[model samples]
Target: MTATPRTAVVIGCGTTGTSVALALTAAGTSVALVDDDPGAVAEAAALGAGTAWTPGLPPADLVVVSTAPSAVADAVHDAQSRGLGHVYTDTAATKDIVCAEAELRGCDLKGYVPGHPLAGADAPGRDDADAARFTGRPWVVCPYETTPAWALETVDALIAACGAHRVDLAPHVHDRIAAELSHAPHLIAAAYTTRFADSSEAFLRLAGEELQAAVRTAGGDPWLWGDVLAHNAGPVADVLDRVAGELARAAAVLREGDSCAPLELAPTLQEGRRGQLALQRAGHGRTARDAPAGGRG
Candidate 1:
């Protein structure tokens, strides 16, 4: 396992892919940015990222798949068959299924790592690609037992180059945590926002910035979020079930108007407060320090 910087190929050329290409090039790696869209590749190249329309498989020293998780297996298989690179990784939100597919495709697990960055804007496409987008963000790295030590180090280097912190966890653990912390919230936000879409334009105009802020993430690419939620359905379902139970309890409390029931509301309120604090801390990169006093329901 060596740590020499080498040529890299970034597949997809979307915002994430372009960001990765730019980061790798900034780290002194010769990057080959690839995507199905010619315009996207050109746009990335214009930003000083490498240019390549057809990245004839195994990639350079590293091949990064920043596409949808549903497309990861096929991309990994193609890259392996072509001997595209010595190491491969993907920025897919769901990792356990992708890891399973990689094993099924006989990919060299020692040379592969699965990762997801915690930072992204509501905007989509290469036009929004920013090399500094991941700075100070948490980059979750889920590596299998067979993943080479060098591969993990290479990934850590890449994370640092992008000014992101690395958080290691197993694929299943990562998926479950993400479901509770990310997927469920996104679903809630989207649902909340959709309820107002039918309102009159004049009525909607009266909404405050607070309401707009709460639903901002609902504007992200639907297809991308669909692939993510679909791939990790089980974990998301588990969280949703718990949430449903809590909602039911809250409804019961509201209907009865008795705060002193066997199902105490205080504990639930406290937990919700703690979760909100944790979220705020994570968002601010201050997880090691005290969070703000405000809480959310």
Candidate 2:
């Protein structure tokens, strides 16, 4: 059966979850917000995301569990046991471990679709949540073999309601891509920003937009990021190693005497320019109106 959730429940009240609630509520879908921390739920509600969910509220058409990576499986299992919704999805960065744990916990596979919205803010609270956060973003869905067609449809409607394009991927593929695109990048930004941690105010005054841009993602909570890195360690480490090698080569080349002119770094700079151009041509980070019709695979 085709589905569009008329009423939904968002099971976490952090930035991502609150943002989802805001989008859904703005779309005229009834949204109930919940969190283990009642204060979080109240904060989201204050932002007009949705009303706080009560224990005996009717089961929603869809339930979005937007907890951190390590808590996603447990949250999903618990939501299912409570008959929270007809179809369930989690917004964790790493999919394999969450999916595996859900399976191990005997969650009803047919009614669940593993998902991640490729949009985030460094803030963990509702301060940074926005209804437009997912607009034009590539929201991924990893359908299990047992996932029912209607369940997928429900999730598609949810993504569409939030103004996002849907991309389907295998669980492992999603994790690897998350590592390359998000996890590793954040780690690299943190590494780069660490240099400034002990810098004097006068030294930091000389920093420019380029330096700020390079370390933008470094503002995220370390505990949250640490869990994400730990969960996707293997894939993230692979990307880190490749990036480290490139930086090492660049460093080694620069260490050479004046005989090695700065222009000798042309190859690496050219490669970076090409990659940036390709990313722009692909229409990444565009508004919904400017984004292309389909999501990347």
Candidate 3:
């Protein structure tokens, strides 16, 4: 692996970026946090994550561009132009679009690996930047065949320092899986949760744990999730279409059902139970330590 980063720059002060800074700082790596919003940087700095980064400093060992998915290419290009670091990576959820745009922008691909840490809160709050957010989480790195060993190793070291496991994948594979595992799920949750937009206070107050748990991801940043869905639209649409079909069939069955009769929804319910069991067996819906570190790609 490449030598552990002695110094790093994180080009965002949101939860994920601040969490990265915090983890790196705790690992004894000197970190510089940067963001266009000075208040955000100040907040992160106040949390002792890192000092605010300014121009004119020597190039860092690595630079983590933790911007929104849509802004990744621009951030990488700008940071590289300014000689921010020797190696670079990003924390965007989708990879294909990011890599394509980066290449179109003429980014230095050899020095960069596209990555995503599968860890974050389901809501948009700046104060949720826990240094242990990535602990034992699976961090995926999408590297091109041309990506240099040093760049990959540098990112591996970053993931390791953050207490995450590295999973290397191709860009297309990463995007496809992210569409299924994250982007589509968030959209579905938000779509379902919209039913409560006009809900009465009494109705909402009666909401049970199941209802809350079902729409947990609906609390995430819509703008961010929208950008992510747009970036991986094709894959996400495919997943959504399949889910819609399943739900439509279930709806049809419900429409024809008798309340006192044996439920015909047994098949659908069984399938869902099986899927959940499979996910649990795969270490999801549980502690991160049980998560597999290998990528299917």
Candidate 4:
């Protein structure tokens, strides 16, 4: 952003979009917040995320989309067709479907870039939209062969503006990693939480910090997560299948309680401990690409 992009059009005033709008606005970029939900638009505007959108507005310098996975392709196509911005990008979790949809629709690819941010809000909607939500987060950018340098830079500008780090990855590799990192974990959380969903208060009293923390993602929108799961079904299913195998093996060992059962579980327990420590260490540091600038609420 040598020119310092002045105006931005943010599509979908959801958690990511609202936060992005607020961060850009705080950085002195005039933002236009658009969403189908009138209440959400009003809420975002009230929070100073951006001005409420109206039709027939002037074209913006950039457009950042944070729409649902199923709607992402059509949204980008429409935005580009309408010349909503000089550069277009999205924060959708799954990239293959959106990119494929844009290609099928013959969308102008010169200004289009695909991205995903690793961090997530504890909840959704305007109430949970934190302008600093992207801080120190790993933001992945998947640029195709034809993706122009300027478009990639434009998105990198947004990532920098949001105080997030930029990571470049191929689309399929990003998808596979995302499945293991996010999609499978969300499903597992829901599965783990469901065991106590209808349990008696007395039975639930046994739950500990580990159980609560592990199932935190169960608090998210089920329908929205289901849509993500459907779009990335292949990779997500593969990860879940592996998880199932491990669980089955553990169950078998517990049930049989053979002489080697303790030895078999020892490696699994030790490996899990190492994984936890690795994740904790990863969280304690900042990536070189993160700008970590001043952010708005």
Candidate 5:
């Protein structure tokens, strides 16, 4: 039996929200784009994304909260209280807190999925929102056991409509991994990149593609990154401690020279190589088979 096309209401109209609305519309879902910013809503609707709205809009079949993690709980509650949607989902970067709040608020967890798209451009705003933004990228879907089967299917279908691949993860697991893979690295990049700015003009001139690429994420939206780091501070702190320990070991190895250098550095270097391989595999839509075989001198 063919299911009826659902009416999807996307709140926020930021980059992520606009993109999702476009994808849903492309998939034959009637969409209404809502945002506190009237201009943003108009821009998205101008692009044929959906109907623009300020608030107090009529209910929809699906309500997608694409706001910042901090705003997700309120958005979910508002949608639920208005009976706005049959199924609700969020595109917040952090999941654990949002999921907990949803459960606490007595929102319909059975029809809620916590989702995060693992891709975005350096720029922010609805202007940067593109249908191709999430193409071939990983979209994490964290569905609870009580999550309705229909809700899961609807969320998965929407993700696919965005041209992204879906991966199922537990909310806590997603938070931890996101901390290690994205949050910590962004923090480090923002710190390290600032150090080079005060160097001599010639020194800065000598900076190459590798250096630029390494620090690119440092240019991300500060408020967004700040919230992300704060929300996942505990897990991020654990990863940072391990990183600090490894750095100390590497420093000692360099001081000791050949006598113990290889011994101390081998594992760290190998782990890094394994991480690179895993990222490469993920990019190529392959499972992280295992650690790549190697050691370093």
Candidate 6:
């Protein structure tokens, strides 16, 4: 069996950090959980995420920073500055800005690997964190060219402990993909949900699976999402522009009462369906690859 990380220091005790800590613990690792607020540390401790941080504690095998995208750079810098672990990593949603910020702030780039776990829940904090949150999920990695081999190995150990599949991508590429698969979708959900905010209860009651799916991310943390969007504005805008154009075309077709073969909306709808199928296939592949050997999944 591949050796998992034996010890880790997880900074930021929010949903992702708490989940990572719990996963690490379940894999027989000793975790030290840290947060800016005493309440957060206490909460994580109560949930058995890990013991609270103490000054001068021995450095661990790895350090995972699961702070919001806005705070990721600073958290990584602080962790490295304090000599926290053998390698430092982050679970920030956006990669480019955070990577640039870390470089601009004179972080130890060779020791830091920026990553994003493509999984989360609407609820925040340790109370809602589950160790299985990252299971069968794609975890994108943005390792600097100068990053050491040991650092990459350290992060791989942590990812293994969490039952996640690792994927390598350049920082800019990661940001672009995240904008399409995550950031822009959140913006669309928020916009869609806001349109019905003033509607009657009966209107809300009419929400079917599709409407609920469309607005699922609308319940996300706005402050955290705002920071993410501000950081990845260019990429998010690029994707949103395409979406907006398609939406306008659909509206125009509806206004002209167009329906039947080769209609304007048909192409758009077909392309959308194709993209959804691609995502479904990708998800199925991940599940199959991660499933236990000879297991009927």
- For 1-297, candidate 6 gives per-residue lDDT tens digits of 347888889998888889899999999999998998988988887888999989898888889998888898888888888898878999989999899999999999988998988885565445779999998788989999898888888888888888898999998999999898889999999987888879999878987988887678888788888988999999999999998998887777688874553565677778889999999998777677878887536
| Cα-based TM-score, every candidate | 0.85, 0.92, 0.92, 0.93, 0.84, 0.93
Clashing pairs in 6: none
- The C-alpha stretches of model 6 lying farther than 4 A from their native spots are 120-125, 258-262
Pairs that collide in candidate 1 are: 57-84, 58-82, 58-83, 58-84, 58-85, 59-84, 59-85
Give a tens-digit lDDT track for model 1, residues 96-196: 89888888877777888989987766556567788878876789998888787878877877787777888998899999998987887777788778888
Misplaced by over 4 Å in model 4 are 1-3, 287-297
Off by over 4 Å in 2: 1-3, 120-124, 261-264, 284-297
lDDT of 2 by residue, 1-297 (tens): 244579999988988899999998998889998898999989999999999888798889999998888998888888999998999998888998889988998888888899999884556547999998988788999899888888998899889888888899998899999998889999999998888899999999999989887778898878889999998999999999999998888888878856664787888889899998987766554543445666433
| TM-score of candidate 3 against the unseen true structure | 0.92
Best-first order by lDDT? 3, 2, 6, 4, 5, 1
Query: Best candidate, lDDT-wise?
Result: 3
Tell me the spans in candidate 3 whose CA falls farther than 4 Å from its real position. 258-263, 284-297
Taking the tens digit of each residue's C-alpha lDDT, what string does model 4 give over 49-150?
A: 999867788888889888888888888899888889899888888877877887788778888888888775456446888788888888998887899888
Candidate numbers sorted by TM-score from highest down: 6, 4, 3, 2, 1, 5
| Tens digits of per-residue lDDT for model 3, 1-297 | 655699999998888999999999998889998999999999999999999897788999999999898999999999999999999999988899999999999999998899999995564767888888998788998887899887888898899898888888888898899888888988999998898999899999998999888789898877888888899999999999999999898788777777822467787788899999998776644464445665322
